[model samples]
Target chain A: MKTFKLGGVHPPENKLSQSAAIEVLPLPETVTIPLSQHLGVPANPVVKKGDSVKAGQLIAKGEAFISANIHSSVSGTVQKIDDVVDTSGYRKKAIVIKVEGDIWEDGIDLSKDLVKDISLSPQEIVSRVNEKGIVGMGGATFPSHVKLMVPQGKTADVLIINGVECEPYLTSDHRLMLEKAEEMLVGIQIQMKALNVDRAIIGVENNKPDAIDHLMKLIPEYPGISVEPLKVKYPQGGEKQLIKALVNREVPSGKLPIEVGCVVHNVGTSFAVYEAVQKNKPLVERVVTVTGKGVKEPSNFVARIGTPIANLIEAAGGIPENTGKVINGGPMMGKALSDINAPVTKGTSGILLFPQAETSRKPVHNCIRCGRCASICPMGLEPYLLAVLASHKRFDDCETEKVMDCIECGSCLYICPSGRPLLDQIRVGKNETGKMIRLRNR
Target chain B: MNEITLISVISLGSLGTIAAIILYMVAQKFKVIEDPRIDIVADKLPGANCGGCGLAGCRALAEEIVKKESLEGMSCPPGGNEVMGEIAKVLGLEAKEQDPTIAVVRCSGSRENAPPKVKYEGDMTCAFAHNLFAGEGGCPKGCLSYGDCVASCDFDAMYMDHKTGLPVIKDNCVSCGACVKACPRSIIEIRKRGKKDRRIFVSCINVEKGGVARKNCQVACIGCGKCVKECKFDAITLENNLAYIDFNKCTLCRKCPPVCPTNAIHELNFPPRRQRPETKAEPAEA
Candidate 1:
């Protein structure tokens, strides 16, 4: 029953896609895979146009330890590697491949049998995860191997698995928890063994009472493990927020959870880790939620990482007649795609199609200073003042107000009655402040 | 008895006089010395203390100017150019003449012209509107008309034109660049004040495809390349489905405005046009 001792808002629990079973989406004729999917540096393309690649074959390799490798989601010939508009509405280089066959990499273990035990050393396990390009898979797409390589002087005592699908309309993690509970638990154990943590905790939001109960039942054998129910809140899955909610301790700003004697991993990330450590499966596929009022069929699908959103929508009964906007993730923090042809990336969690009525914006007026934004801010920063200072280009003032601490949760925007864009301007302010700080440092 | 009392009184009075003289000498010794010009410059400042000059106050600005030999690009926004000229004269420095400009919103999509793409029920700030989604209209690049710029403008010159859903700067605009910074899309620009308050600028900021832009707003530029074709001055350039008018090369000929099929090109400060034999009535919006 523990929750973070800070601001949180409970919007309507419109968990419409919760009950929908995850369906496998049909491959499209072509998939446009973006290289800049993960958090760090963009992956370097290893294939050129007209080169044939099999599913699961590495098409892009990591250029940095913090980056993830991109694998071909479908056996196809490279169509082109060109700039394409992504969900964030920014032009980024992407790899386009035309599907030719259902050929998968020969090394993949195509089996339903559970591999409960792996005797690989922690280093070997981490190496396999790195080689397979396994990442967080919880919308962050932070390289899992990089996270496992904790900074020196910091020791992890516990590995907390985040199974909280707190954002509205995202049920990928929930469904994954229900069906892959055993595999997820195995993944958590592997992570604990790798980190040499004594205990592991799987935190689930109370909204998913069934998921919590199922995980509890499946996890009875691992006495070192426990399932803690969390207060359903937006961004509960965020690293610092989750750590605070589970352990009642705040991870200091600019420091990871492991730095505070804990390491956290997502449930989906655990599954991906399990595959990487055991079956040598790279992160080539993931579960995607294709649900919204504008979607004719609201459902979840186990989609390939580079699957085009159009293909997922088609599998879910095509785009609805009223569809006017398509977001790449949940409504709270997702980026609305200008082009539906953009493919799913490692961080893609949901493809939310909003009808015209829900997608359009209202004319902005003066802020009435309702303070709802401050009340709902998880990071405990005032967004109204931040936006004002940003509008004035007061980078120094923004820094004084701790603009760098803003987690970009969109909660302030979600609660603002006057419909202010507090996050966007704050983003600009934070960027400016960061530049000023860097310049001063240099 | 009078002699003894007089002698004691004189001794006390001498001691008192000696103490007073010593105190005065000490006070003079410790008195701090500062340049007199600091006070004179401070007194001449506007005293608004707006901090737009990056100084603490008028006194601080005066002190810095007197102490620092270089004036550089420092000027108090509230004091206008006259105060700067005075400050420069006092410091024996040259006051830089700046071009007078005003904020011009590049978007013409008002509620009547640019319909809402989605109804926003969230906060009513332009910053929030831009972050939450694209403009209320389907055009992602169009003016949000949320009035963040209008609210940010300290001067009463900028107002949200209800008909256009965009901020309009009056002739009294001081070119503070406050509105230009407030706009999330960067649609507000400090354009030169042309003769007779007339200048030519592009009205559309929509970078979406012509089909999408037209679907979002009726007044959006369709990117038909018509203005580019008609322009003989080579002042217009199109990119990302939006046309921009290069004010430097523009001759204010008003040729591009008439040739723009979508009326995306706007001409300002021009005299009333003479009646022509045939002309189309303004299109009714909404």
Candidate 2:
């Protein structure tokens, strides 16, 4: 089993939803589709009040090269377009639609037939993925179309598919691989075709032998595709870490996976790409894992883009009375949602609820000079020093220490003996340092 | 040994004398002529380097005052008029008196007035909360209740009231504007301290429409323009679905708060009002 060379932690694998088969969540009566779902400039809404929109209709268009288009997830009358509180606890412009029926767009293929024929050319595949507004479903939500366009002077040699749901309680990708193995392989082929790569590898943690076995058995039909079992470790699913695990290549600091002649995509993203290229479907719905110790029933649901998380909780056996915190993703990297009414976005991979006992964040203490944070940082940067510099507003020093390279895996904060919030402080540093770097570049 | 001691003493004496004369000559050549009144003015000014006057320190400000020979724009916020009066007396210059000001929180979204719709569980600092959510209440433009202003106050002049979840400024506040700069949501305003400390200000910063703003907080200013119409001094203006009263133009007639349908205006330190006017009561008795 291969793993990244740098430091990592072994958080307990709380796979409560591993056995829960994916259930299709019923369409919400009203869907609030935020325009700025992806990690770029927000899309401009094309529809206004009283406009009748069908499912998969382009409600907002992504005009910027790095943005993703937002589509309506239900056929409904446009109730209103207004700012609604999203997962980030901030108000953002979103299209609100009251569902009237299940009418999809004229061009979208709603059938679930497995179409394996790759009829689209490489250029056509790229353009279709772009039009479908496909994004990295592994939680970063970077516009998939932008990643497909390999910059000049760079060559993508191999494609790495991330199947490692290394976060403690997440099993969405695990379920995605097992339930849709054939579709994923075909999706990988589509991604490979789009990237113009010869070889592709699916990196799965050894803890998930069933998924690996399933993919391994299905790989015979697909040439030049391999499944590599990785050492079961937290953050093994990180793009850089996964690349280093499978291909023995390290993505240089501040550079992308392309620096090492590779491009990484989530298994979910691969499936989305296949659907977009072969089925003419836009990226709309995804598999979300709602599980925790406090949850009544941990389960996975095939949720639409604008489904209210409250509905998922009700489906998963209503939110427990003692539940004190509701997170948007896995325990290690997810954000605490202020309201359960928040709608799931392209990046929401899991929703974890914790009881009052488990939600008690340890009181922050002074650094004890134990050097645990430095030893456990996956980026090989000193988180202890970064925390100190960021707290002091020394952004220049933070930039010099390479704070922007931090992947925010929460590994350092998790392992710190003194309960220092290294990741929290480093987030501030990264923001300030990124702004300073941008200003300097200009 | 005796002869050597005498000879060394005489040589050292001559060398010391020569070095002392050279040092004196250098000191005289590089002597910096400065106004003696700078030190006197600095002594009269408080030494707190709060930077409220936009200068480095009191000593630096003294030098600027002595150089400019004018106190047109140099008012020590911490020491206020008394210190400036003393400085002016020493410099033989007419000192301009400026009114004292203090920071007042413009939002009244207390726990009772504006109930929290959601709970904030992250960093308890107002700045972090301002970026994270619109407070627990749906008012994105109001106080975050995290007391960032309280934390930024170097004078220990602000504190968070647990019952109300709002910051209360102490009387010792020097009007230094530290809290103003510290607030991420710009909820704290430094307004002119009125006669007998009586002042009025709208206590809501929610810029949402009347319906939306009222939906979030019971006392949110709806910008209904009732206060604007009632203000006889033409001190109020409505913009962006929010009403702002100019303190400079406001005569403190105490009319706007009574006309505010939502009771969004706050009155501070005003005497109690009688049921009827004294003239009318006297005439009725007669």
Candidate 3:
């Protein structure tokens, strides 16, 4: 099986929610939508506190070039606009709504039937996706419109749909591929049209054999679309890693996948894009997996954008008695929520509840110099050296070692038997060094 | 010696001397003009090259000063006030006097207050803890108790207190602020060292509610607003369930110590007062 030439670690594939079908979660009485959902800038609030908003209505608009728009997940009256704590423990301005009815926007075509063809121009499709606030649902929440906007002088040769649900214990993408195969195919075609790419590949991990077969069967109707079964691997969904795994090309450091003549989209993102372009439906809901040993029930559900995590946990039969941590995503890179009231945003993939026994509790010991972390780092960085430099307050030295390149995948942390937190210190070094560089430039 | 040999030797010698003199004259005439004040300022600097002042070295700083029109917050750490004053005099500029400060870790959550949830047996670094988890302890905001602060202390003023699992500042602390930069939690702060090394600060960084903060560390600031109410000078502001004391408005009245519910606010350097005056006096009159 061909994998990315760089380092990767295969931990146990604890995919507990693989068989769980997507169920619509019960709408909460109130929803709190935060403005900063996408990667770049925080969106500006467009609706006033007393205004009534329908499902898929534009609630917030991007204030900067790199930001994405935000939409109302449900028809509701604006209860309040106030600062709310997010999963990361930071307070951000959020829109609170008291749901009035299941009234959707009149323009949105809420049809169960899949629309195969979209007559909209490529630019119009991109604009619709942007207006609908469709971001990449593969956990990064990058603005979809921005990704679709190929930079000037650059062209996308191949569009790759990432069906590789590589992160262990998370099957949201897997279920999306299995259940929404046709929608995904249509979405892939839509993406191909947007990128003006003739050829497209949907890379699914062999673990989801059924999804591969389904996609392969449906892809024949679309001439340029094909499904390729990828060997299951952790972080195979990373844009660079997936591109390399699927196409045998390496995206150079600090370069986009497009630079290597490819564009990768997550399966869920493709489905959302399909809906956005075809039916004029905005992205308001996403599949979320609630799974772990600490939860009584492990399942996947189509969760609304602004639902609180505590409600999701309650729907999953509540946390067990000895739940040690409540992570907002997969165990490897997910943030442990300090506030259960933090609402779900666009990029949340899963809610992992780990029992105290299953949680990692190793003390920071001396580096055995095993070099395992460096061996498995996909970015080809020496995490040990960066850790040492950061430890000694040699931030400049850390910068010289290019510590900023760490993707915070938690591979180094997961592989380190000595329990050293290489990512934590490296993140600080990156931020501090960036600030220093900025100060120097000023 | 033969006449020819002597002539050759004298000719070579004269040629060498003339070339040396010409080189010397050229070196003097075409010398690159440099500001003499830069040298004077550089001489007055401590030359530790710590780069804390955002410059490369003492020479770079001197050059920048000579080139710039104004100097503000541009004092070197190793030079201290005396050296800064000297440099200021040399440059024909007035030096601004700043309060000498040192970094003091407020959180006493060493092993006793904030117990470690897991034994981190990897690289001993606060940065590692910050990235991997929020910290080593149960509190997401608590200090990692790693020696990143100690490592950043170029003056050797801060050291890890083995028993407390916290960095202790010594009298020799120069307030260089390298430790502040190194600390991932931003717990290490540069504050004025009150008379006789007395000072006050909030020890805990936990902004979680009282119960939750207490669950993580015994000394976390729960943002109960008690300190804000107790302060007579209106020096404190509570936001995001965290209390911030504005040092400029703080009167050092020690009014907040008793009011803090969680002992998150710390007071140091105040004289201990006796309950009662001594009534008896030594036999004086003969």
The Cα local distance difference test for each model comes to 0.81, 0.87, 0.82
Cα lDDT of candidate 3 equals 0.82
The DockQ-derived docking category for candidate 1 is: incorrect
lDDT of 1 by residue, B5-114 (tens): 99999999999999999999998999878999999898989786646577787899888888885577677666667888888888889888654556688888878777
A1-442 in candidate 1: lDDT tens per residue? 7777688777777777898988877777888889988889889999999999999899999878788888888898999998665665545789999999899899898686888886999998888888888888887778889888767888888888999877888899999999888888888888888888869989999999999899889887765889999877777878888889888778887667877888888899999998878777888889999888766668989888767788888888888888877888888878877668778888899989888887766557689988889888899899999999986779999998999999887888778888777877888788778889999999
Tell me model 2's lDDT, rounded to 2 decimals: 0.87
Off by over 4 Å in 3: A361-365, A393-405, A417-419, A433-442, B1-99, B104-147, B159-168, B184-267, B273-286
Model 2: clashing residue pairs?
none
C-alpha lDDT (0 to 100) for residue B29 of candidate 3: 96
What ordering of candidates by TM-score runs from best to worst? 2, 3, 1
Off by over 4 Å in 2: A364-366, A432-442, B1-16, B28-45, B55-75, B81-98, B117-122, B275-286
The DockQ scores of all candidates, in the order shown, are 0.12, 0.35, 0.18
State which candidate, 1 or 3, has the greater TM-score: 3
Q: Please report how far candidate 1 places residue A132 from its true position, in Å.
A: 3.7
Tens-place lDDT digits, model 2, residues A137-192: 99999999888889999999999999998998999999999999888899999888
**Among all windows of ten consecutive residues in candidate 2 chain A, which has the lowest summed lDDT?**
A420-429
Native contacts kept (model 2): 0.35
Candidate 3 recovers a fraction of native contacts equal to 0.23
True C-alpha contacts between chains kept, each model in order = 0.12, 0.35, 0.23
